[model samples]
Target: MEFKNGKITKGFAFLDTYELTVLMKAKKTSKAMKNTMEETQGYLGMWVTEDGYIRHELLPNNRYDEDRGKRESAYQGRYKVTGNHIEYIDDTGFTADGDFVDEKTLHHGGYIFHKKLE
Candidate 1:
C-alpha cells in the first residue's frame, strides 16, 4: 500500500490463485448465509403429515424440532434452506434433506408434508 497527501494512492493487494479462490468462496458463503436467513422466515412454522404423525417445526432461529408419533422432540437440529431445498443436520450427527413442492408442501424421506394451519 502507498499513500500520498494523507490519502491511499495504491491500496489494492494482488492475490494468488488459491487466495483468490478462498476469498471468492468466503464471499459466496456470506451471500448464501444472508439468503438463508431471509428465506427461513417464510418457512418458519409447523409442517405435518396428513395423519399428524410427523410434526416438523422450523423455528425463527434456524433450528428445528421434529416430533414423531408420540415422541416429542424426536429430532432437534439446525437447518438451512437454500432456495426451496432444505438440508438438516441433527444434533446426533444424522443428516437429511428435503424439497418444497410448493409454498405449502414438502417432500422428505418418502413422506409428504403440508404446512399446518394455525
Candidate 2:
C-alpha cells in the first residue's frame, strides 16, 4: 500500500488467520513475536506505536451475520513493505477484553483484513 500526506493509497493486505498464528510462534525474538500479535489487532482499528515502530490498522471483517458482535474494536501489528506484497506480524496476542475465540472450530481461527486508506 502507498501512504502519502498521511493518507493510504494502495490499501492493505489481509493475511490468513491460521497462517498468522503459526508465524507468531516462529519469531526468533520473543519481543518481536509479542509485538507482531499486538500489531495484528491494532491494525484492525487504528495504528499502534510500540518500541518506536509505526503500524497501520487493517480493515475488519464485515460479514454481518457471522461477525456482527464478534469483531474486534482494534487490531495490532505493523506492515513491512516488501516489493509489492506487505508482510504482517501480530506484535502481541490479543489485548485485554479483545474478542479472540478459541481455535477449536474452523471459524474460530483469527483472520486478517486489509484496505487502502486513501
Which one is best on TM-score?
1
In candidate 1, stretches whose alpha carbon ends up further than 4 angstroms from where it belongs are 1-40
Please give the lDDT score at residue 15 for candidate 2: 81
lDDT on C-alpha atoms for all candidate structures: 0.87, 0.37
The number of clashing residue pairs in each candidate reads 0, 28
C-alpha TM-scores of all predictions: 0.66, 0.22
Q: Write the per-residue lDDT of candidate 2 for residues 19-85, one digit (tens) a residue.
A: 8888777764675534433354432343222321323344454111112233543344444332223
Q: Residue-wise lDDT of candidate 1 within 1-118, one digit each (tens)?
A: 8999998888876769998899999999997655532365567899999999999999988899999999999999999888888899999999999988776898988899999878
